[model samples]
Target: MALLITDECINCDVCEPACPNEAISEGDDIYVIDPDLCTECVGHFDEPQCVVICPVDCIPHDPNHVETESDLMSKYKRITGK
Candidate 1:
């Protein structure tokens, strides 16, 4: 499943660069994740870089955008052409 930045985000700017898929970006009030491009790092790493690097632990799975591991892998392939 894609990850979402919660309101707890401090806008620390660490997550944007950590994302291999470039799924994170600066929003008006906080960083936002592009669910279409987010694969939870399935193709890039064993864990989501943003979640691992987050200082405030604001990154979490989006329940509204629920997806299985297979689904995440598919998204990763589509994003990376791998």
Candidate 2:
């Protein structure tokens, strides 16, 4: 599943750079994660980098974007041009 940044985000500005997929960005009121670009860091690391670094722990699985690990890997591959 893709990760989502809830309204709890404080716009700490840390998640954007930590996303290998560049999925995180500053929204009108908070940070937001693009589901299409999110892979939960499956192909890049053991865990989601944003989740590891998020101070507010606002990042969570996007129920609307639920997908299998294979789907995540496919996304990662597409993102990296692999």
Name the runs in model 2 displaced over 4 angstroms.
none
Q: How many pairs in model 2 have backbone atoms within 3 A of each other, for residues 3 or more apart or on separate chains, i.e. clashes?
A: 0
lDDT of every predicted structure (CA atoms): 0.94, 0.94
- Candidate 2 local accuracy as lDDT? 0.94
| Candidate 1, poorest ten consecutive residues by summed lDDT | 73-82
| Residue 79 lDDT (model 1) | 86
Per-residue CA lDDT of candidate 2, range 1-82, in tens? 9999999988889999999999988888998899999999999999999999999999989999999999999999999999
Q: Write the per-residue lDDT of candidate 1 for residues 1-63, one digit (tens) a residue.
A: 899999999999999999999999999999999999999999789999999999999999999
Task: Tell me how far the alpha carbon of residue 42 in candidate 1 is from the true structure, in angstroms, after superposition.
Answer: 0.3
Any idea what lDDT model 1 has?
A: 0.94
Models, CA RMSD each: 0.6, 0.6
Model 2 per-residue lDDT at 9: 89
Pairs in clash, predicted candidate 1: none
